[model samples]
Target: MSTLNPYCPDCGAAVAHPHAEGCGVARCLFTGGRRLSCGSRHRADLELDHACGGDEWTGRWPGEAEAAEFGWWTCWDGPGPEQGWDYQGQGWVQVPEGTPGAVPDLDRLSTDAQWDRHALRWVRRVNR
Candidate 1:
């Protein structure tokens, strides 16, 4: 099995070892306690203790446009009924959640296919 290394999911930085006396928070490594640092800094304690599952991707992709452009769809309908489009352009487009993974050959698929593939891959990566 692969060992899980704790790192700052936000900045992808390695976490420093926690001090000898653990912080009251179960997973915090900083003995000084959790405090907001530079906007770029992410506290391991806060992230571990307070963040929920959904928080993992909180700021990673914050809006619908970002989701759509990057090929992310929260639901199968591709954001909404109006926005939905199918691969063949024949029926109401419905991009299912957990759709096919992103296609590296994006130039080969239609716009709808590209978005569907990318969104599925994004969701899978974040969920993992």
Candidate 2:
């Protein structure tokens, strides 16, 4: 079973040790929420990246126990098939930057919940 604890299952960083840069398991030290550190993408040009990326001494990822309390999940897009899935091109539109409620580009299986999240149409896989 995957979990966060004295050591992160993904990055293998101890509770006291700083999580590696861009570690997906890291949490947001700036916000008092259950959101992950990478809830938003990091870009060098964005002024907010410095503060959001933990440049101001925000400590390591939260431990398993604390994470469990908030029902926080390290990975939002669940597991996929062994062969994995690919992003589909249909039902997508190119929108201007900073558009509210913009659809995120997804690399997902047809059955992924993200497909339903945006009401995007998908077909069931057929066994060969």
In model 2, state the lDDT of residue 34. 25
Q: Rate the local accuracy (lDDT) of all candidates.
A: 0.30, 0.37
Clashing pairs in 2: none
TM-score of each: 0.17, 0.30
Per-residue lDDT for 26 in model 1? 21
TM-score of 2: 0.30
Position 14, candidate 2: lDDT: 64
Taking the tens digit of each residue's C-alpha lDDT, what string does model 2 give over 4-120? 246656666765566566666654454322235344345443335434434211233333233233232332232335224563333444344345433322222312221121221
List residue ranges in candidate 1 displaced over 4 A: 1-42, 45-61, 76-128
Tens-place lDDT digits, model 1, residues 1-128: 11234544444433343222222222211221122321114444333443211112222222223345545443222333565544333332345335553213222123333222223222212322
Go through the candidates in order and give the C-alpha RMSD of each one to the true structure: 16.2, 15.4
